[model samples]
Target chain A: MKKILLPVLILALVIQLFVPSYMIWQRYDVLKSGTEVKFDIGLFDPYDAFRGRYVSIRVEDAIATSFVRGRYGILEIDENGFAKISRVESEPPKEGLYLISSEENYFSFPHNRYYMEETLAPEAEKVIGASAEAYITVRIKNGKSVISGMYIGDVPIEEYLTE
Target chain B: MRKEKWLLDEIEKWQTEEIISPESAEILKTRYAPKKKINLLIVLFSIIGTLFVGMGVVLVGAHNLWYKLPIAARTAIGFLPLVASQVLVLYVYLKKRDSIAFCEGAAILNMAGVFSSVAIVGQIFHLPSDFTNYILLCGVLALPSMLILNAIAPLGIYFWTVLNGGLCFDSLWETPLSTALYVVGALFAIYNFRAENGRAVYVAWISVISGFILVWVTSLLEDFDVFISLFAYFALLGSASVLWERAGRSLEISGTAGTLIVMLFATYEGWWLSSIKSDITIAVLTLAFLALAIGILIKKQRVVPAALAAFAALLLRAIWALVGLNSEPFSVVFMIVANVILLAVGVYYIWAGARKVSLLYANVGMITVCTLIIMRFFDSEMSLGIRGVVFILLGIGFLGFNSYLVRMRKKAKEEK
Candidate 1:
């Protein structure tokens, strides 16, 4: 154990020597470069002691929400707030275009980047909270994406339109 | 023969307790009979060392020599007291060889030197009076030396490192980096836990708390609101409960405390319910968690009363949430009544539980139920006189009960 520890300690020391103090670099970079997306904001779970809320976001164009709802078809949303999609389509489209809402849920998240319609009421009801909006930035640089940051205002709509 | 055996046992115990050179101890046991020469020498050297250190302090305090001394000179001068003290100790240790006074003196001098190092460095640098910078500078300056020297002084140094690390987390590292540092610290603590005794327990506790603090800080930087914060805390605690279930009962005790602290913080923040409202899915998930935890308690035949209390409190909040407070909906009253019923049921379980576990669960459950009742009473628009009287009576009752329990515990300990 001592022999094994010696080299590891030396390595840690070596790493420390080389590790320049670049504080908050990752936070700054992620905030700067992360992809911005709009989802439906569902609720805010507020804690009294820690003093924060968990904002749930419902992605308007979620394929899995549809699948869970047993809805057959791709979903498309019109500017008139109308949604339609073809179940005849064998697989989800690759373009990743969808009418998204800014709804947020704490745990339940969409599996794929496809559009969703309001076929699942109970699911949507479970997503409701102290608020009605959810939009967050997703870092999509790799094949993976996660909630990088959340937006407080209607920046999701503004960013979607502008970008 | 028995006396000889006892003497040998005592000698062995003393040998372990005395951390200095074993040869010195054996020599002291044999050759170092009490002599005026050794005492005189120890006192003489100690006085000389004290004078040297005093002079060094005076030199530093004189201010005229401050700027004249280069940084290297200043650093060297700052260490003069330590050097002098060590030399004095070494002389006494070699000459008189009193291990008890030598070790104790070494401990004291080492502590003093650590404080002086921090003070002198801060003074010489003309550093601002900010706490974070002071702690960071102190830790950074002392840590490497402490570890390399194998000084027990690292206990304080590592503590300061972790403390300043948490305070400076937002500014010190990206989220990942912060998390990594915390993990590194925790790993160090775990490494210490394999020691021959519980000597590393402090390190373990510090590491766990510091790691969680870093986690919390990182989450805050991500703008996790109070509700999410509670969820995160509870989630982490629940995870820890499952993962560290076998680490030992001592760790479990502390872990339970940690979980309780999180739940208390959740209740205090009002996030326990808001998080649920923010997302029903999360609410349901938390409920499921509570149910699962409760099941664990029941199945294990050892209720984690803290967990039960937290879930019970959550139940009340859920009911309150179901009936909007502003609306004063029927749901609120119904839920509160139902909660009262649940509390009764929980109390019944406490009474029915096996004697071994009942006390533990009952204390925690009753505390939670009492807190809930108190909160409800305080929140309700009752008459001031009645409220005041009730408050006083409840406070007195709690104090009296706790005092009686404490006395009983003390008596039990004395008997043991």
Candidate 2:
């Protein structure tokens, strides 16, 4: 084994010198799309300079404790803990909520299903962490779904829409 | 009576085999001849020493003389230092092909000088700091050494070239590319197919540092996301497993971390329960993974632990999915039962195997089982303080066990 290790190592090293660079390129495109082109749907970072104030969001909770004045749909927290926004199939499901067919891949925005583990009352603690609250970044790209973002206070959607 | 019979049988067999022929004795004596020349070791060492001195000079010159010399002259002088070293190497190589101290070292050293020179020259000439171009130039120059010197050094240069190419040419290098490349480089570095001790270790270390650089580069590219980062971690872990198996290098830490990262990422992605979404898919994936584990184990491969851990995680994901889909009261009960059974079987096999088979592989299996158990426990609804305490205990346990096992194994080897 010792005899052949040298050549084997060299071969591996050389091969690495030529792997495709496509993965890296694609990652950059994703990063650029996220940071530079700011299209505000709901989610906001207080430090997000362009969007004057912290954007409030409509939390999609299972209990349906509170109401959004004009909600696009309900989102569900997937088992993976990501809150994907999907159309509310039935108004406030009694049992487990059935997700509305958004005709978009769950991985992409404007289609994924998100379930809220807890309710977000207005001016309440938005997150379990130091962040204000958890809200979604809704982009109408390719369809519409919430990109998970920092939490903020619950505000009337009507107020933000008018602004 | 049986022991005495066995001893009598052994004595008879020994007496029969102990008779040595005259021709056999002559052949054995000839094979052990001290007069046999091994001049290759001397030549190899000379070349290696010269290469190291050359590198030292370059480092010194870079600090001192390089600044004083005209940029053009500095560029030209790079060639001179290397050329002088190469001339000496070639002379010895030609004169004493049979004796070499460490051939790979010389090759690596040779390319190190060459690459430094080219990179420096390119810098002086105001050439585009593009990584790919630098790699291309280095690749062309070092190409001969790869073929002729039979050294691993040129490979090091080649790696730098490729890595630089990605950094300069690929915009992704500014983002995930750096992380991705670092992962790729680290995999190459730990790839030892034979003896653990050799000149290749240095190359492997270089690869590791480069990988760290890659990680740093990627950080500059974008903000860290759990999913993408985990994906990268998984890729690194998978490759690291291969390195572990091939080189027998102790990369279990990276491998374990990588696997954990990926699993966490997958859980966050909500793909953990993907198998449960379709029972057939779950069954097929499980079978596939089990098959892989069995295959590895059959071959006594080092990567069996990695495969097993992956299989266990996938199994858990499948169970979680089923529980989600079927809101029956007994769903969780069934899931728990299934995991318990599987864990029991796995532990039994690992323990039994340890007692009967080779300890190295058995130790790996045990470690893997323990890791999975720890991972699952952490995923459960435990308090933060409790979980932290558990994690600390597990870490200490692992360290202690491995340390004790290593000592035992070493002692056994010495006794043998």
Candidate 3:
């Protein structure tokens, strides 16, 4: 029993580690190669039991469009590097990253919120809110997107919030 | 120690009565003698101390200290607790494998380290706050260690996390991930049962909770005929009660409670008067569940009178619907009959438990009787004076019934 159990435990552990590592690695790969887009965001802080404290972000462009359930919306970036929904599409776009919304109009963007320390999350929120310009930088590749960082007028929000 | 003393006294009495030979008595005494045991105080302190230290590490990580440190140093800091916990568990496994306190303490610390590491890694990398993904990742990472360590606490935490993830993240009951999780939990439960580690109860609870969530999700997401979802919910509860009986007592208790609660919910007038089609479907399903409950009772030969009473009440309400009695007075009459039946079943359970010397059944029966009588006081439209009189009479009757059971028990013991 012991002989059989050890191998099985090792195998399960390998699989467990492989999943999260693979997901993180995939996001890393996207950030390394994908197109970067910025969107202005409104911030609020909420506490989740499992995910700790996070600053919830609302993308102005993603919220502007009326979305049908199970459909994708096309987003276009302007010269200022801010994005907005150009039109709602029934299928995935031919070349660009698109937003998919649920029946309740919740979109699964590359990043919805930034997780931080519980004590510091409110401070982050306050700093983001105080900034005249707050934008989220996302990297999109092959229809998948990963959030790189939050920026307050070109400086990472973490730098300002920490100081 | 109390049990040991009682056993010694019983052995002495048996020897005096010549129930066993002198040699047999000596063997019994030797077998019943308590063995040297680990100090429970030490075990308690060790567990508590490890938990506090683990929480401290998590708090340090939560402070975003990783941001200030160099990449190499931050990586080491993030992974240090996890590696330390692993080393501790390995040492315990190799050197103190026979010590339950050391083994469990190391295992608990390892579990905590796993969660803290995941949270730290997520925070440092600025991962999105997708609870479903986070919980699934945690469960996968923790489950293997839990199995290896035979740790029940982490296993229970993982199960509840899966449950919350499914309820919060999944929409329209189309959560294939939750379904997969339920299957995983059931498999783990079976594995624990085979291992005989007494941790199967946690897994069984997970299965029950996940099963209920699945039913709720299905009810909400599917566009079904009116009573079909209701029937399906009851069927799920009935099947769970019958199927998971071997899991543990907790599952059995939960199953019974779930059945009763759903049945009580169904007794609302809206359920019966929704439509003729709905009324007919509810009536048929009630009869089916009643038959199933009776079959279970007969096979088990256990006095689960609460389940029986619930099924019977649902059946009565269905029968009332069939009779086309949609009047307010008729509904009141049906409620009264249901309460009376509940009271009678409770009394029967109390009597049966006393006869068999089973305290759990008797206590449940007593609570049921009290609850039903109190419900009547609120549910009925009787005058205040009449209701007060009814309450007093019922209280006296309950006292008399309890005294009767006590006397009966005494007589039985004396006869023995």
Candidate 4:
């Protein structure tokens, strides 16, 4: 048992560790060189006892399209510099960034939650709530994406709340 | 005499009664001791300790105070606790290998560390919090380590996590998930059932199987799940009777008792009347399991639980069919019938337990009857003062009966 277990256990642990390491690497790579875009977001607050608290984010599409999961949606910057999907596509665009809808009634951006300190999340939610316009800066490349910063009006939510 | 139950019982009684000093008892017992007797307390503590570690890591990940650092540094440090935990586990695995408690703790902590490793990355890069995928990752990735390290508690936690996942995520794999977990749990039973003295194995197998049942319970098909549970529990009971007679009684007791309790739930109109968008799948699944349960109960000579299942199935069938015919009469009839069945079951339990001198069953029966009266009181149009008086009287009566039964049992034992 010991003879066979050592190698197999080590391999399993390695694979286990590798997944998160690979996620960090892949996400970092996307953030460093990915095409940057901003999207105005609608938000609410929910407390996840397991994962602290965060703003639950939603986005309105600039151009309405069939809400088909697994289809690619092409990105185009709107008049105010926030992103809007130009159209849904069966394949990735030849020379521009796109994000895939993972759920039927999908939010355009890949990431929805911006996890924060338990005490601070409600404050952020209220800040976003009071603001007339809010957006989040996202770095997107290929089909992978990450939320860089959440904004209240024109100011970064973190900086705004601090001020 | 080495493994004789009477000898072991005598030794235990002698130790407990202070007739022999523990060390002296141990010395005497060594000659007659069985090969292995898994310490249930240690195993139970191991499970709890492991849960604390797992929950601690998750809470700490949620606390996440270091996101302002550069992404690279933040990401690098994420694996720090995970690495440290892995190192500790590896050392325990290779060297200290001291006790089951120590090894089980180390292995389960490592499993939690795997969850933290991934979760911290999500925290680091502000990844979307999709717990379904996240926990599924944790359960699947940590599974091999659980078996390889012989950590049964991790298996419990694994099923528990997926059970929550099924509830939280509402996956397509709900039934399949339970099936798969039961396969492992049954394997654990088969492996450990006939051991010299196996409390820890019994506990582990119960956790795994009950975990499977619980996950299956949290779904849309209410009528089906209730009867299916009977079949599953009794089948488990029957198999335990054959494969491990001593442990089988424990399983049989819970299995039948559990199905009876579930039948009480089936008595509620809400369970059958839920407009849960059913199809042919529900009927087929319910019928199949009900038949299997009836067969097992007859074979095992379990008349009471089998009769309970039979009653529940017929009630379920009649309720669904009558509801289809748009009959309000059966709905009204269901209430009277449910209470009648409830009253009958309660009376049977009381009689069976009293006849057999099994105080636990009799008390359960008494409690069941009391609950029905209390429920009726609440449902009745009686004044608050009147209801309150009834409640106090009922409580006093219950206490009186309980003591009277205890005295009677003691007298019976003294006579014997």
Top candidate (lDDT) = 4
Which residue runs of candidate 1 sit more than 4 Å off their true CA positions?
A1-163, B1-73, B81-122, B125-134, B144-157, B165-178, B193-201, B208-212, B215-221, B227-251, B254-354, B357-359, B381-416
Q: After superposition, how far is residue B87 of candidate 4 from its true place, in Å?
A: 2.3
**Mind giving the per-residue lDDT tens digits that candidate 2 earns over B32-129?**
43444445556556556756775675454343234334534654564555555455445434453333344554555556555555544432322222
Pairs that collide, model 3: none
Model 2 vs. true fold: TM: 0.40
**Candidate 1 per-residue C-alpha lDDT over B1-416 given as tens digits, one digit per residue, 9 for 90 to 100:** 45545655665577899854688667655543333233535543553464355445533432323433554575566555445544543444345344333533443353344445444443333222344544444344333333432333245345555456554644334334334444544565555554323334555566556555654554444443323334333433433343332333334445445544444433332333233233444445445655665565566566444344445444555555555552334434544444454455345445544355757556655664665565546554435786588568867976897799799999999999
Show the colliding residue pairs in model 4.
none
Tell me the whole-model lDDT of each prediction, alpha carbons only.
0.43, 0.43, 0.64, 0.66
lDDT of 2: 0.43
| lDDT (tens digit, per residue) of candidate 3 on A74-163 | 778889877776766666788776755433343344456776666777997888777769888877776566777788888777676767
TM-score, chain B, model 4, is 0.66
lDDT of 4 by residue, B122-178 (tens): 876777767777876777777776666566666666766656655554543445764
Give the C-alpha miss distance for residue A87 in model 4, angstroms: 2.5
The best candidate in terms of TM-score: 4
| Winner on lDDT (1 vs 4) | 4
**lDDT by residue (tens digit), candidate 3, B1-416:** 88898999999999999999999999999999866566767766776787787777777667664465643465567667777877776677567777756866776777677667777667655676665666666675666666676655455566666666666655424566765765676576656643333345655666567666655544344433333334333433444354444454655566556644554444344444443333343345445645676676668675444455555654665566457665676765665565566667667767877888889768766876766655555753456897688789988987997899799989999999
Error of 4 at A17 (Å): 0.9
